[model samples]
Target: MNTTYYMSYKLSLIASLAGLLYGFDSAVVSGAISHLSNYFSLDAAGTGWAVSSVVLGFMIGAFSGQFIAQSLGRKKALLATGALVFVAGIFTAIPYNFTMFIVFRIIGGIGVGLGSATAPVYIGEISAQKIRGKTLGFYQMMIALGILLVYLVNALVASWIPDSQWGTDYAWRYMLGAMAIPGCLFMGLALFLPESPRWLIDKNRDDEAKSVLTRINGAGYDCQTEITAIKKSFQAPAGAQAQSESLFSRKYRRVSLIVLTMALLANLCGINAVLYYGNVLFENMGIASARTAYYQQVIIGIAFFAAATWAVVNIEKYGRRRLLIIGSFICFVAITLLGALIWVGIASLWMLVLMVVYILFFGGTIGPILWIIIPELSPNRIRGKLMSWATFLIWTGSFIVSQTFPMLTDSVWLNHLFNGSFPFFLYGLFCLLWFLLNLFFVTETSNKSLEQISAEMSQA
Candidate 1:
């Protein structure tokens, strides 16, 4: 391969490792949390808190990531995040008590949150607009890969230890500790990639920006032209920064609202709730064996993996808005069927089939596509901060849905009102609302550069 192509490929690989860290953080706990709950002799609410604590830490870190990116530059911020996660992973595995375990999980969560926000922003900033969407798909693909890796790893670990030992005290520690090796690898790789040129230019290091851009783009492109375009985007008219306050600022109200709505749409389709709580959901539905539930959950991870891989390859061709519209409708139908099957007292097998279909729809369309839209919609100057705030909201939505699912399902009052299908019905409602929102407000971004998209949005 050509030297420039080789460098670019390596850089993309390193940046995408952050996504792998993200995926591991998400999937590892699903296997370990159950054992931890039993070891601590915890109740349902305590178990939920143990599971959702990382999400809360993620919200805090995401909220903090914007300022860190703006002040530190993408490369430095990512390195710091990786290092923190490395330590967090160690802390997570060695905790001797419940409080210590929760504390370490929170720390690890900070790493996940920061890496999730920074990796895509780094990939988006460094890549040429022509291939930017595809580059970001690598980030999402690794996230799916990481999820798959953790599930397989957890299964192997669980098999080696007797069932009595799994919850006796050590299984949870081993599950969390296994992450340290990957976490360390991510940190080492991050050290090799260059800082984002757009961030360098924002720091007024024009010569350095030119050097980095040249390395990524090769000898044929005009560095001056690229720099000028970035400068224009970065330095808007007077009071423009005020207009770009956030997804809620009056100046950015339309774009902000669209981004927030999409983030909510992504989470409320109930994918995380399903992933985090799937084993229990299966058991509750009368899948008699523990091993059977775990094996089924692994199948869910495979479905997620396949869908994300397909998305990474097809996202740019299909476009973000189109996928959202189509995916929302598909999810609506799936959830509607899922609820109907339960409400009508269908075979348990049918519900499992619907769950797989739901996973397929969410992973293929919404999971990968939501991140694609989030970064693309923001102007370069504010992209990091806006993405951070938006991610904060997404993590918050995850926390809410994951925490509330059990209560919604078990509440006698809600059961009386919704007749044992409240979670499905509520998610179905979210899916329908998401579809309408997309039809009315979201814009087509296919074939447009980020610069062009921003220009169009500004004109509007």
Candidate 2:
């Protein structure tokens, strides 16, 4: 209700638009994949490649995001990413061949990778410690909104075009290209936003950093104390030079390992495989027809959006590690049940209900918390580098899942073992594993200052 809180929310919300672009760009492909397969005469491998190519680009962009964010500043890096998204969107809609389509998809994916890496880091740097978790959760909320919006767009476009033209023509094009509208909005608005105050402090622009921090933290807040704490975080120990150290150096080894493992675990839990192939999976389960699958996706998206909103509200209240462990257990149960239902040839409505449950658990827990926790775990001096590395790992995991889900399900040996639902069963096992990992290894970071977290990591 405070005026300064509103200002902070406005800024954080604007930056979070990058998440929306990432979500829309990523999910739009879900609706287009079946059409693409028909249009290109794709086999399982080709279909997988078409769907997962963006993740390949995501890996590349994430790998390079640190350099871009450090060199050009986070705002500029995001603006460039937005431009790339717009270009990729336009080209993707009109690609002359499958190869060209893949290229454009990769390009858009690079933008997604960059935005994903930078936006949360930017938001984390600007946010007050008390509200940081919810603020970062806002980025995940935007991602959910983007997915929901794309599903609606896909449904509308598919309905407008005749069924005969669905596989061969313009409907998919419109869906892929509609991403450009948000891309442009992100670029234009990013230009007006300030650079990260922490980043400015790192660059020794103390006056400017103080100005920005004062504005965001409001008139009553002690800007100097916050700034001092930030400065203290960057100070090195007796023999160590903070700026000279790599993220993988002995000092950061523990924190780096935690973030890298968390990132991999987040994607390997099979979130993207579900998001990217929900329509096909639903049809495979006999829950809906291909035409009806688009509408079903709208339902899935709504579930995801609502769950993410719940996460944003309750993340600080419940603590990150607790929610992740609980959510992972829920996901494990839901996915295992789903696999069981399929194996037994039970095509009841429970299958649909379980899918929604799985999504709710995922979106509320790992989906948003992964982003929130990573930023909190890393020290400001290496935050960009560490986040980029973690995101790279995340996308690598995503690429593996998105590219192999079809193959895993279609595997002759696995099919023999689990009646063609092997992948979901395997993912369910992963959820259980992740739950245990979080229980044993993950730390509670809710309501902690970044400086306090950095100190804790350093001590550990």
TM per candidate: 0.95, 0.97
lDDT for each residue of candidate 1 in 1-460, tens digit (9 for 90 to 100): 4455566666877898888887888778887867877888877778787888888878878888998888988887788778877887898888878898788778888888888788888888887776677777778778888888888877777777775765557877877888887889988888888999988998999999999988888877699998999898877578667666455555566777778777766677677767887777777777535556668878888988898889877888888778888888888888888888767656578788888888887888778777777888876756887899888888888888877776777788977777667798888888898889888988887667788777766554
List residue ranges in candidate 2 displaced over 4 A: 242-244
Residues 1-460, candidate 2, lDDT per residue (tens digit)? Answer: 5565776788889999999998899899899888888888898899899989999989888889999998888889889888999999899999999999999999999998999999999999988778889889999999999999999998988788666665567777999999999999999999988989988888888999988887887777788888888999988876778533677777788888888888887888888878999889888888888789999999999999999999999998999999999999999999899889988889988988998999998999989998899999998767899999999999998999999998888788888888877888888888888898899988999878899998888663
lDDT (Cα) of model 1: 0.79
Report model 2's TM-score to 2 decimal places. Answer: 0.97
Best by lDDT: 2
